[model samples]
Target chain A: MEYMIKNKNEQLTNWVNEYSDKLYSWAFYKTSKKEVAEDLVQETFLSAFKSFDNFKFESQPQTWLFKILNNKIIDYYRLLARNIEQVTDDEFLSKKTTDALFNNSGQWVSAPINSQWEEQEHLLDNVDFTTVLTNCIKKLPQNWRIAIESKYQEEKKATDICKELDITSSNYWQMIHRAKLQLKICIEKNWIIK
Target chain B: MRFFKLSCKKATEMVEKEKINGLSFIDKLRLKLHLSVCKACRGYEKQSTLIDDFFLKTSASDIDNIKIEENPKLKETIINRLDNES
Candidate 1:
């Protein structure tokens, strides 16, 4: 009995060392905050340890751990949404920026059509594109980042996101629209234009 | 043009919202009409959705760059706590 328990503890420790970095990276990708990611990773480990005996080993240990961390990310986002306050105005993006993109007659101000981005479909395989995307996501205001990441990456339902973020339907739609606009413009300037 | 008079701004918002939630029939009609006349808004819609498609397709990949290092003491703290509990 003593020997079996000792081996179990040893295996758990090994998991901590092996999976910690992968788990941290995933958590950071979801949260985009180092401290929150670290905390979630720690929480995941601790929870796994407590429930260690219940794990059936049907799935790979890494898969099991990832499942727990994914749950943690969702819970974090849900909590954030519940606690977030509604914004009174368009705080970060300005009307002038929107105007520059569209004219008084609701037409494109500059060239009506952008250069055909032939390579866009292949950008997924490009590490630099992902890096640029990550940087652009990071550049957004915290709420915008939260909104975009939750909506796009997590693929949460609009109503659920609105409930979590304490925003109305109109507010939710507007945020997503504005955030995507900014992201599109940012990518065009950095990746396509240059 | 009045019935189908969706401005570029409103048309773009509808385009973005259409990805997650279905757009209203009138809004959809307006967007289609606007896109028919407005090449820039059309380009914006296509490119904006492409950005979304890029994220959805690539998010599943093993692209790791923003690495977060756990505090060295975290393991020790967890182990100690578990020990105390047991």
Candidate 2:
């Protein structure tokens, strides 16, 4: 019994050292915020440590770690939902001036465009990108922040985020819309025109 | 109306992902109106279109070889946090 315990401890430590960086990178990509993703990675490892004894080796240790990380991400999001009060529309949008009516039918691409839209030149311009978005995210209500992070940073689909948050389809879209509006204002305030 | 017409962020996001279509009629019109008058939106539209084109043309691996900065004390930091969990 003593031998089994010692051996498992050694193996888990090795496992931690080997996979931590890759897993941290994955988490970083999903969460965007370095500190938050690092915190989650630590939580993932702690959970793995506790459950090490029960691991039956049905899957590789990496796969097992993945399962744990997925649950931790979901829980982190759920806990935030509970703590933050629901966001109201006006608090979300600066104001609804009646300048442009929404036209939902806009095609994603308008005739292939000039194709310069995706140029790496613009993406890597090191332009004051953050100057544009600095306070935009802060203005969002907590719930909307989670939705946006999951949507873009995590690359989770709207469907999956809605399912995880237990929000209806309409509510999900509305929160996304409000988040985008705030972001737009921030972008407009900071963009450098050539 | 001013915000909607002037803001091209939506168009930029969609164009980045090569994801278009599924917008409603009114949304399309609003976007068009925004694009017609707004220089910033026009620039964004141009930039996004180019980014997509580059990705489509580049056959190389999407993976970037970013140098990893080890938090030398990261493990210790995490271990200390775990100890406090009790």
Candidate 3:
């Protein structure tokens, strides 16, 4: 029993050495906060260690570790949203104003802002532009960042995200809407218009 | 009354909704009707789709190369915590 336990410890230590930096990088990107990111990465390793037996080895260790880390990030985002919810009654008022993308008579309040994305796909080849987008995404409010990341980056379903985050469907959609709008404006101002 | 038709606000919301969930047949028709007359909303729809595509492409491997600054002691701290738990 001691030998088996020792072997498991050895393997876990190797995993910590091999994957911790990559996992921490991904978490830090998602959270944009150093301490929070570190804590999430630590929680991910601890969880992975606890569930070592359940890991059937069908997937790469990196994949399994990332899956656990993604859940931790999602839970962290949900916690942030919950805490933010407690202090912001105007959240609903702000949501209603998200519709202000258009005017009272149903016309766009301004010209279409997304006009210059013709070279956007090519921007993917430009590493600096990609970093700019990441920075822009990180600037979003926590819940909006969570909504956008889960929907587009993580490719999760609306129902699943809503349930996991304990958010109403209406609020989820609002967050996505607000996130995309803000991202478009930010990218346009910082990248395209620049 | 123009009450039955989709407004620009409603049309854009439907466009975002279509990204998350499929639009209903009537909602689709409403969106189509709105898009037919509104060039800006069409621009919004196209851009929204582009943003989704950008996100997917970005996620494919962005972290592989990001040089995130690391705390040298974090791994040891985590392993120590795990050992304590066990």
Candidate 4:
């Protein structure tokens, strides 16, 4: 029994060496933070090592590892969502600047300020535009960021995202709407004007 | 006109809802009418779709191309944690 455990440990170590970079890259890509990504990768390996006996070995270790990592990412976002729910309110969705987009009668206050965006083809292909857009996304409130990331990065169903985040479906859509509004305004300010 | 008319705010919400959850028939019609007259909301729709497509396309393939610099110590750290666990 002891010998079996040791053998499993060695196998896990080999996997750690072989797949850590790939896993780390993926986690970083998902989270956009190095420390969080590293911690998640470490947790994934630890969890995998603990469950070594349960791994059927029919699937590649890489697949199993990624499945664990994906769950960790989801849990991380879920936690962020919960924390935001407790700490904040719907004010994030109804910022004064966003309110300024419309008049009291709910009519647009100005002409389309983003007409400049329409002129630019393949905006993401421009490295500077991509950089500015990335910064704009980062500037969103944490919950809004999670909302956008869960929708886009994870490609999750709206209902599933609401369940995972413990938010109502209405709240989920509202956050996505507000996040997109903020992103559009940010891009216009940072990229279009500059 | 008020019955068929949708506020720009409500129209924009419907626009977002169209992407998230398809709107009801009346709601769709109302938003369509609003956008027909509201150039600003039309701009909002175009920009919103652009941002959505940007994320959708990038999330599909951008990560594979991004090279996140590897941490040489990450392996050592995981191995040490495993050792501590056992």
Best by lDDT: 4
User: What range of 10 consecutive residues in model 3 chain A has the weakest lDDT sum?
Assistant: A84-93
- State every prediction's TM-score relative to the real structure: 0.78, 0.52, 0.80, 0.84
What residue pairs are clashing in model 4? Answer: none
Best by DockQ: 4
**Which 10 residues in a row give candidate 1 chain A its minimum summed lDDT?**
A111-120
lDDT of 1 by residue, A32-107 (tens): 6888988898889778878988888787899899888887887787676554454424433533454577677765
* Model 1 residue A142 CA deviation in Å: 2.1
DockQ of 1: 0.48
- Per-residue accuracy of model 2 over B48-68 as CA lDDT, tens digit each: 343333323231222234334
What lDDT tens digits, residue by residue, belong to model 3 across residues B1-86? Answer: 26448777678878887766667787788888889988777877876777676788766655677886666689889889878866
lDDT of 4 by residue, B30-85 (tens): 88888998877887888888887778877777444878567779999999989888
Candidate structures ordered by TM-score, highest first: 4, 3, 1, 2
> In the order shown, what is each candidate's alpha-carbon RMSD?
3.9, 8.5, 3.6, 3.1
Better of 1 and 3 by TM-score: 3
Q: What ranges in model 3 sit over 4 Å off?
A: A56-59, A81-101, A112-135, A157-166, A187-194, B1-3
Model 2 segments beyond 4 Å from truth?
A: A18-39, A53-67, A82-84, A87-142, A152-156, B1-74, B77-86
Quote the positional error of residue B39 for candidate 4 in Å.
Answer: 2.4
Q: Which segments of model 1 are wrong by more than 4 Å?
A: A1-11, A82-96, A103-107, A111-132, A155-166, A192-194, B63-71
| Model 2 lDDT tens row, A2-87 | 78766766666676676667666666654556887788878888888787877887778887886787667767766665444554
Backbone clashes, candidate 4: 0
Q: Considering DockQ, which of the candidate structures 2 and 4 is the better prediction for this target?
A: 4
Listed models, DockQ each: 0.48, 0.13, 0.57, 0.60
